[model samples]
Structure formats: C-alpha cells, structure tokens
Target: MLPTVILPGYLESADVYLPLQQALTALGTPTTTVPLRKRDWLPTLGGRSMIPILRQLDRTVSAALVDNQAAQINLIGHSAGGWISRIYLGDIPYTIHGDVTEAEQLWNAKAKVANLITLGTPHISGERWTKKNLDFVNDNYPGAKHPEVRYVCVAGKSIYGEKKLGQWLAYSSYQQTCGEGNTWGDGITAIKAAHLTGAINIEIEGVKHSPRTPGIWYGSPAVLPQWTGYLS
Candidate 1:
C-alpha cells in the first residue's frame, strides 16, 4: 500500500493532526503531515493569494514521494486543505498576488496522487475570500470526477442547529461556513457542503470537525472504521 500525506486546514499547524496521523500510521499505512505553521498563512491571507499555500503543499507532496519511494501516494486533507488539494490537482488556475505572470501548473503534484479524502471539508462556502476559489474547484472538478484519483468526502453529524444551548457555537460556525444555521454539521462544516456529487460520501454520527475536545474525531481509532476503508 502507498503511504498517505496529511494536509492541514487554514491557519492550522500540522501538530493538531498528530492523533489522526498516529492512528493511520498504526493501521499499516505509513503517513506524513505537512509541517504547516500559522506563518504559512501569512503570504496567502495577508496578500489575498493562495500561491504560498499551494507551493508548500507541493513541496510536501514531493517529500512524501521521496520518503516513500512510491510513484503515487494518498492525500487526506481537512477543511480548506481538501479544496486546496483540488487546486493542486490542476483542474483550475491560480495566481499569486493577482499577477498572471505568476501562474502555476499542478500537474506534477497530480501525477503523485492516488486517493484523496476530505474530512469535514466545505465543498461550498459563503465567505468571499474562499467562495471564488472553491467555486472554481467545484465547477471544474466536482467530487471524484478525476479518473485516476478516488475521492472520498466525510462529514460529522453531531450538531443539528442553533436551537439548543449546546449547539449555538456550532450553529454560528455552520452558518458562517455554509450560509445556513438550521442544518447538520460537525460544528464548523455543514454536512450538505461536506459531501460531493460523484465522490463516496459518508457521515459519522458522533464525530466533530477535529479531535479537539471531549471526543474522538474522524481520525481517531474509534472512528477509523468509518472512512479508513477509502485509504487505498
């Protein structure tokens, strides 16, 4: 089996995903995560560009390929990282700091991908900063449309809406992400947006966005049975 490369989300560091990485590694598939720090977002968020993030991901991909000595590897992206992986797959075009001269091709990265899995990734979003980029990804490469790659989208079903006191925070986050409050989600990404049309979509009953709190997440040992089947 090929090794798996894990990518972090927006403003996220690779350390937070250690639980999931350790879990996957223990399951027979060696895994490596992008060493992303908060500063990695500085060039993108501050400059209104995505080049920095994409380039960093590309480097991580290269490293994974070298370390595993395999022609292809699997990708497990969480949240924004999932959609960004789409951009890396080369279906859409992107520029750095709005300069067309800085355009890049992700074909090299695409050549190294085997399976791509997304955990609580918002396939659609309402925020302007992400809407344009996500729209491009969804429009060009919706779901598991790529013939060479198997796409799997995972969603959580722990929070329903803002009605209950316990759901207020999730509700607010869901509304901001999916532009709707009265829906199901994993406290941050709505289930509706987390699923894709052609990909293998799955929903977990008690998992949250990440393993950040009182319970296990999509990457935990308890939830591994839910989506790990697609790792190959």
Candidate 2:
C-alpha cells in the first residue's frame, strides 16, 4: 500500500498526477495531488524557491489530507515537480534559516521519507547546478534521521531533439536549459549520476513523449506491472 502524494511540474496541471493517484488508490492506498497556485516568484526563482514553497505546500496538503497527522508519506514528482519533492522530503528546515524542530519542520519528516520517486529529473551536479539543489538530490541530504527512503528514478529512453516539427520546437528548449542530451521519457539519466547523488534509480526505456501526451495515459496499466517492483 502507498501513503504517497504526487506533485506536478511547471506549467503542469493537476491532471498529470491523476493516473498514478488512481493507480495507487486502486491498490487500496490513499493518494492526492497537491494543488499549486500561480505565484509571481515562480518565474524568477524557478523551482529553486522549493524550500519555502514546500513549507507552504506542507501546510495546505497536511491540512487537507492528514488532519495534522501526516507522518509517513511517499513523494512522487517529475521535472520541477521532482525538485519540489526533494525540498519537501529533505530535512534542512526551509532554507529560510529557522530553528524549528525537525519533526515540526516543513513536510515534517522527522520520521523518515517513506519513498521518494522521481521521473525524468536531473538530481546531480548537472549543467545548471546550484548548491542548494546539489545538497538534496546531489549530496543525498544529511540529517536524514532515518534510512534514506527508497529512491526510484524513471527516465526516458529516447532523446528528444530538434529533428522534426514536433520534437524540435518543444523539447529543444528544455534540454538546452540543462545542457542535458535531448530527451523525453526515454532518455536514460546515467546511473553514475544517481550514485554520485545517493539515490536508487529505476531506468525505463522506450516510452517516449510528444508533448502532446499529458500525464499518465489510460493505457499505462500495461506498463504498471513492469514498474510495480520499483514502486514497492
């Protein structure tokens, strides 16, 4: 069973998380998507403002889901979604410089991260790297206070490039931003990258995207069995 929550990436709709949410729920686990409001700071800071945003998000999600008792929760995120997930699961106490108890800190993971699953995210000292981002996904975050939760990264197999009408215009910009090889859901992020960052990665291949596809497709049940072990 899963006691997890899903978070979406930038310019994404809550719809992106619906499939996985339903899948977990079908497995008889509670799941929900954390709704994010449009913020003025998002464009300027990107997800680098993740610490504060997660603190605020923790308040809303914990309130709505746990009634103040959200102890063990799996956090599944993609892209910028994964960035926020790392900040939420991490234990540095909101980078805002506060003295809050670890248990009382944002996302309140004094217990431990039940699971941290990321999809198509860059978790190491990559091209546009920053120390803050480096610490969690990069340094594996000290003060975990528990066994670092199981980490599963599902990356794309095929690289998306500016070859045709579809891939070039849409995906080229995203890859260029990170100095990453052009990719969609099929590009494999090096496992060495995960080792350097201290997270277990589950590499999946051949499920490319077209920017036309939204979140999980209704047909993904066929692929679900393949990833079930990773989910476990």
Candidate 3:
C-alpha cells in the first residue's frame, strides 16, 4: 500500500489530525501529516501566497516517499488544503503573487501522487479575498485534471443552508463558496462546491466540515471507512 500524507486545512495544525493518522495506521496504511503549526499559516493570512505551505507539503511528501520506500503516495487534503493540493499536482506555474521563481518550480507533484482525496473542500469560491488563488487553481488545473491520479471528493450533508439564524453561517459560507446559499453542505462548504466534475464524488449524510464541529466529520473514525477505500 502507498503511504498517505494528510494536509490539514487553513489555520489548522498537524496535531489536529493525530486521530486520523492513528486510524489510518491501524488500517495498515502508513500515514503522516505535514508538520505545520497554526503559526506557520500566519504569513499567508491575507491571501498573500501559499508558497510557504506548499514548500512544507513538498518536504513532507519527499520524506514520506523516502521513509516509506514507496515510489508514490496518497494525499488526503482537507478544506483549503484540497485546492492547494491541486496546485501541487499540476505542471502549470502558480503565478498568483508573481513571486514564484524558476528555481521554485518544484511543486509539480503529480508524478509522486497516486490518489487524492478531498474532504469538504470548496473547489470553487466567490469571495474576493480568495478569488485570486481559486481562479489560478481553476484556470490552470480544472476538475480532475490528472488522469493518472484518482480524485475522490467528499462532501457532508449534515446541514442545509438557510437564511434563518440557526443556519445563517452555513448559508453564508455556501454562498461564498459556490454562489449558492440555499443548499446542502457540511456547515462550511456546499456540496456543489466540494465536488469535482470528473472525480468520484461522495456525500455523507451526517458529517460536518471539521473535527471541531459537532457530530462526525471526514476524519472521524466512522467516516474514514466511507472514503478510505479509495486511498489505494
């Protein structure tokens, strides 16, 4: 089995995914997470650039390859990490901030990835703050762009976005993510926004977006079985 690397979401530290790493290990799949702390995301706070995060991801991938003695590995990116993983897998130069030099063009990771599983990732976004990065990802590497790597997009259907007070947050998040608010989502990303056109899309009925949220999430022990089957 190919070793797996878990890329946590924006502002999330690697420690938050320990439960998930342990679960995957118990299933016989060697797993590791990019050693990222919340402080590491501070530099990219204003949508400036994700180059720093990508660099950490590259190092972790390299280490996973060497340590596991595997030619390729599986990547499981949650939330924003998912789209960032898309950028990592592409050959196109990511030029959002216009700071990526030729020497920094080492993020073309498709050759080292066997499968990619995204959890409640907003593949599309309408918010102005995130437009530049999202645009670059969509324009350069569209849905399921790489045929060699399997793409499995998972969305949770625990919350229905509504204008009411109880669901207003979900409603607003869905609107910002996919330009639609009155839809089903995982409390942060709408199902439509989380899915890719040519990927194997899945929707879990009672899951939330993150582990911190009430109820089961993508990384939850119960939910892992729902999508981990696609890892190999």
Candidate 4:
C-alpha cells in the first residue's frame, strides 16, 4: 500500500489532522502529515503566496517516500491545501510571487503522487482576497489535469446555504466560493465548488468542513470510509 500524506487546511496545524492520520493508519495505510503549525500560515495570511506551505509539503512528501520505501504516495489535502496540491502537481511555473526560482519550485510532485484526495475544497472562488492564488491554480491546472494521478474530490452535504440567520455563514461562504449562496455545502464550501470535472467526485451527507465544526467532518472516523476506498 502506498503511504499517505495529509495536508491540513488554511490556518490549521498538523495536530488537527492527528485523528485522520491515525484513522488512515488503522486502515492499514501508513499515514503522515506535513508538520504545519498555525503560525506557519501567518506568512500567507492575505493569500499573498503559498510557496512557504508548498516548501513544507515537498519536504514531507520526500520524507514519506524515503520512510516507506515507496515510489509514490497518496496525498489528501483539505480546503486551501487541496488547490495548493494542484499547483504542486503541475509543472507550470508558479509565478504568483513574480518568477519563482527553480530551487523554490516543487519539481512537479505529480510524478510521486498516485492519488490526490480533496476534502471540501473550494476549487472555484469569487472572493477578491483569494483571487490571486485560486486564479493561479484554476488557470494553470484545471480540474483533474493529471492523467497519472487519480483525483478524488469529496464534498459534504450537511448544510443548506440560506439567507436565514442559522445558515447565513454557509450562505456567505458558498457565495464567495461559487457565486451562489442558496445551495448545499459543508458549512464552508459548496458541493459544486468542491468537485472537479474529471475526478471521482463524492458527496457525504452530514459531513462538515473542519474537525472543529459540530457533528462529523471529512476527517471523522465515520467519514473516512466514504473516501478512503478511492485511495486503493
């Protein structure tokens, strides 16, 4: 079995994915997480650039490859980390920061990744603050661009975005993600925005975006079985 690496979402730390790592390992897949701390995300607060996070992701992938003695591994990215993984998979130069040095590039990670699983990731976004990075990802590496890697996009259908107070947060998040608010989502990303055209798209009924959210989340033990089958 290929080893698995988990990349936490924006502002999330490796600790937050401990449950998920343990769950995957328990399922007979050796799993590890990119050692990211909340403070590490501070450098990219304004969505300036994800180069820093990409650096860490590359290091972790390299280490996982060595530790497992495997040629490739499965990559599971959550939220912003998903799109960032798309960038890592592509050979297109990441020029969001004005001509990335060759040394700073991820050296095309797709070659070492057998599967790319995304959890409630907003593949499309309308928010101005996130335009730069999202634009770079969508424009360069569109839905399931790589043929060698299996892309599995998982969406949650726990919340229906509405104008009402109870669902306003999901409404706003959906609007920012896909330019529509009155749709179903995982309290953070709309189902439409989380799926990729050429990927194996899946939707789980009651799963939220993050572990901190009430009820089960993408990384929850119950939800793990829903998407883990794709890794095989």
Of candidates 4 and 3, the better by lDDT: 3
Cand. 3 Cα-lDDT = 0.92
- TM-score per candidate, chains pooled: 0.91, 0.68, 0.98, 0.97
Candidate 1 lDDT tens digits, 40-88 = 8877673266677777787888888888888888999998888888878
The lDDT-based order of candidates, best leading, equals 3, 4, 1, 2
Clashing pairs in 2: 156-185, 156-186, 156-187, 157-186, 157-187, 158-186, 160-183, 162-168
Score each candidate by Cα lDDT: 0.81, 0.52, 0.92, 0.91
lDDT of 2 by residue, 150-195 (tens): 7666555444554576556434444543444354433323322322
Model 2 regions lying over 4 Å from their true place: 37-48, 60-71, 96-104, 107-112, 125-146, 160-198, 209-219, 230-232
Global CA lDDT of candidate 1, please?
0.81
Tell me the TM-score of model 1.
0.91
Candidate with better lDDT, 1 vs 2: 1
Instruction: Tell me each candidate's RMSD, in Å, in order.
Output: 2.1, 4.9, 0.9, 1.0
- What digit string (tens of lDDT, one per residue) describes model 4 on residues 116-190? 999999999999978998998888888999999999999999999999978999999999999999999999999
TM-score of 4: 0.97
Better model by lDDT: candidate 1 vs candidate 3: 3
* Span of ten consecutive residues with least summed lDDT in model 2: 187-196
